[model samples]
Structure formats: structure tokens, C-alpha cells
Target: MTNYLIDNAGVLIGPVEFPVVPGLGVEIPSNAVRLTQPLEHAKPGHVWVMVDGLPEERVDYRGVVYRTDNGKSLLWREVAELPNTVTAKAWPGTHYYWTGDDWELDQSALAAEKKAQVLLERDTLMQHAQLRIAPLHYAEQLQLITQDEQTALLGWMRYCVELNRLEQSPEFPMNMEWPVPPTVGTP
Candidate 1:
């Protein structure tokens, strides 16, 4: 059986159970935590680290310090979240914090305030004039135009095309402009 202590820095001091092979019967190195066992329902002082939901080997959860050995080095890491602390998965959820009195949801009263701000912004955009759509009527008359008419209409868009390099050999613009694009969706 693996030996554990009930004292020290909650470091679990025990050898992992390894199966005995026919020819390989050598002992392997391991990590152990010396905890104040008699295993009470007390919070671990500083043994485990609770970073994510994924189980961590070298973390002290409650009163147990988990340890892991990856054949190379034994790791005894502490999770980011300490015991007796309230936490949440992400934003827009009921975030909890450890209050002196008890575990409280949103120690700061900013959850509803921030959510209201987002709703206000959304409503403002929906009521803006730019958001209203109008029925666009294409020209009913078939206007006869030369080949150059269509190209002239699209001249504003040609600022993006790379010039003075291709075999097509298009003439350069009246003046050189930076190759920057429109920050917004519209060109």
C-alpha cells in the first residue's frame, strides 16, 4: 500500500503502484504530498491548482493533493483556483466570488449594468437611419452606352488593383495612392 502523511505541507508522500514485470523489477521515482490526514473535510491550504474542469494530477482539491508522474519528472502543480473560492466558466454567466460572509454571485454589482449597455447599443443601431432599407428601382430605360462607360463607373474601385507590373500594362492612376483598404465593410 502507498504510505501517506497527515502532516507537513499537504504534500502526498506515497509510491505509485507499478506492476512487476518478469525481468524489470526496479522501483520508479514518484512524488508524494505530506498532508494532515485523518482526512478531515477541510480546504487544502496550497496543494492543488484548479485551472480548468479537466482533472489535474498535482492539485490539492479540498484536502487531497493530487500528483502525477510522466516517466520523466514528477509534477506537483497547484491549480489556479484555490479552495473555498467561487468561480465561473466564462462571462455572461453567474460569476461567483468568495465573500467574507459566504460564496456570493457577482461580488461586484456590474453584471446587469454591462448587459444593459450591450442591449442599449443594439437598440440604437436598429433604429438608425442607415439600417432602414428602401426599394431600389433599376433604370427601366435601356441606355445605350459605349464600352468605356461601364469601366468609367468602376474607376473608383481600381485603386486597389496592382499596377505597372503585369503584361496587360494598364496606365497608372493620375496620382499614386496608398494600397490601404477601407476599414469598414464598404470599399
Candidate 2:
């Protein structure tokens, strides 16, 4: 009932339904091959091949991910187990890097991305610190602030200075020691 047209490599071109030739019954195409027991529909991602003069079914994994030595795309099973190939999910921003033999996380790139995020966080903390410091500095200049207010102002200033010095720490952006803001009501 169903015949498949295939290329020389046995890759399926399309399915064909032949008309009855009256006395001859069905007129199958010369280039078409059919399974011994043909199914109504062919399975997806399957290849039909002539093995030992009979049609055989095999998997077609041309869509599988395979990368060349320089990270260019290529078909899977084309160069499988080859020394210069890296096979892994090639999705964007996954941070997967090819080493000489295997895939690994690119530490330097990861650190750089994390550093940028940390810098943004530091800038935000500094902006919030400045908001608290500006009014206190003005109060001190007018001599209208109490002793408790002076101590609070000094604590906030020290916190600000610590925040500025965060980059000087040996851990820096990678494993930073964030400066805690002074408590509002505590001495």
C-alpha cells in the first residue's frame, strides 16, 4: 500500500502510493523501496536502507550536536570518537568551553561575568550609603545634631569607607566581604 522513495544513501525522499496497473495490480516506482511488512506511516528520524538485499530501518541522527576542534558545527556520527571533536549541548550562554580533550566550565569567563554583577551591586550599595551620609554631613555642619546623631553619622561614614575598600580585599569581587550598614536604633 505504501512505498518509500529513497536516495542512493537510503535517505527517505518521500512516500509514494502507486496506482493499480489493472492486470499487473500495483505499479511500484523503480527507485522506491518498501519494508517486508510496510507500516501505514514511517517513523520520524528514521532511515531506510537496503541491507542483504532487504530494506532495513536505522536511526538518522544527523541533527545530533557535534562541534569541530575550532567549535564549528558538524553532524553527529560523522566524526564520532574522533580526537578533535567535542560533543555537547551548543546552546547560547551555557558557559560550556572545549578543553583539549573534553568540555569544561570556562572559569575566567564565569569570573568576569560575576565580577560585573558584583560591581553593579557595589554601585547600588554606595548610592544608598550616600543618601544616608549627605543629610548627616549637613546636620553636623549646622551643629544641630545630638551626640547620638554624631555617633550614628560616624558609624555610617565608617560603613561607607569599608564599602569603598571592598575591592582591596584579597577575595575582591569573587568572594567579597560586604560591609554591614549601621543599625538604626543601636548605639
Candidate 3:
């Protein structure tokens, strides 16, 4: 007969084989239980649990396959599934948090991110518009600007103004209606 040593929580600690004296009955500890089939060595992240007096394998995060003499038997618990969030998987530029029971959007963080993106786009557009207007403005002061150059300068200036006014819109950082930028060198 094969006897398995178990703890108070029924975790299989080790095995005590029978017939230690060849023909004599084995001396088993109080925590040992006899089993019809021999138990194999438990794998990592798994434990041999005694469910209703029957040995069964269960998932154990603690990796408590076997314990030393001074080690304590840990209670087996069923791990609950994690709640699904709006962003199901982790990726770059994505943020999510757990709100006690469910995953919720961090609105403030999203707003801040959106605001930064909008500001970056606006700065780029403003710089482009300013560059296009500089030579045209100087040419106009010298009376050397053509009508097409004057028209292009006005369109670029208007685009810059629109870009600056973007932050004043009601949607602001959340939803922005970006103004159409003028063509590179035409009105």
C-alpha cells in the first residue's frame, strides 16, 4: 500500500511507502492518507489537492508543489478571470484602469493625450504657414509682390489664425474640427 502525506488543507506533501520492514506494516503519520493509485510529482504552478478524499491536480500560483519540513501548506483557491477592459490588450499609447468591478476609461488621461496631439499638429501647421508668409510679406513691403503671391499670403495667414482658434472650440481636446490648410504655394 502507498500512503501520501498531506497537510491540514489536504495538499499532498510527500509519499510514505508501505512494508518498510519487508513484511511489516508501514507506520504512517496522522496526516497521511492511503490511495489506490500512486501520486506523481506535482508540476510547477500546480498542486496535488485532495478533493473529497480523492487526489486531483489544481492550478496554484504560489507553485507550492511540495513543502519542506518547516514549510506551511497553503490553501488552494480558484483564480477569478480578469475583467475585460475597453482596450482588451496592452499596446503603445493605450491606457486603462480598474474601477473596483470593471475596467473604465481614464478620461482625464485621454483628454491630456488628445490635447498634446492637437497642440503638436497646430504648431506644425502654424510654422508652415508662417514660413510661407515671410518672403511674401517682405516682397509686398517692397512693391515686388504679384497678385498670386498676395492671395497665397492671405490664405496662409487665415490658416494660421484658424489653427490658433482651435483651442477655443467647445469640443477643444476631445473632438476637433480642424480647419483646412491652404495649398503649398497657391491661394
lDDT of each: 0.33, 0.68, 0.69
Give the Å error, residue 89, model 1.
12
TM-score-wise, the better of 2 and 3 is 2
Backbone Cα, N, C clashes tallied per candidate: 19, 0, 0
Stretches of candidate 3 exceeding 4 Å from the true structure? 1-93, 184-187
Between prediction 1 and prediction 2, the one with superior TM-score is 2
- Put down candidate 1 lDDT per residue, 11-45, tens digits, no spaces: 43342344566798844434332233233232544
Ranking by TM-score: 2, 3, 1
Of the candidates shown, which would achieve the greatest TM-score relative to the real structure?
2
Residue-wise lDDT of candidate 2 within 1-187, one digit each (tens)?
A: 4477766555555566777998899877777876555643445656666667666566555555647344556656521234355454463344556765566777788878888888888889888878887887888999888787788789888987898887788897788778898986233
Q: Which ten residues in a row have the lowest lDDT in candidate 3?
A: 63-72
Global local distance difference test of model 1: 0.33
Root-mean-square deviation of every model: 18.8, 6.1, 9.8
**lDDT for each residue of candidate 3 in 33-131, tens digit (9 for 90 to 100):** 888778887776577878887888875543221122112334323322222322222222245554443345678989999999999989998887888
Best by lDDT: 3
lDDT of 3: 0.69
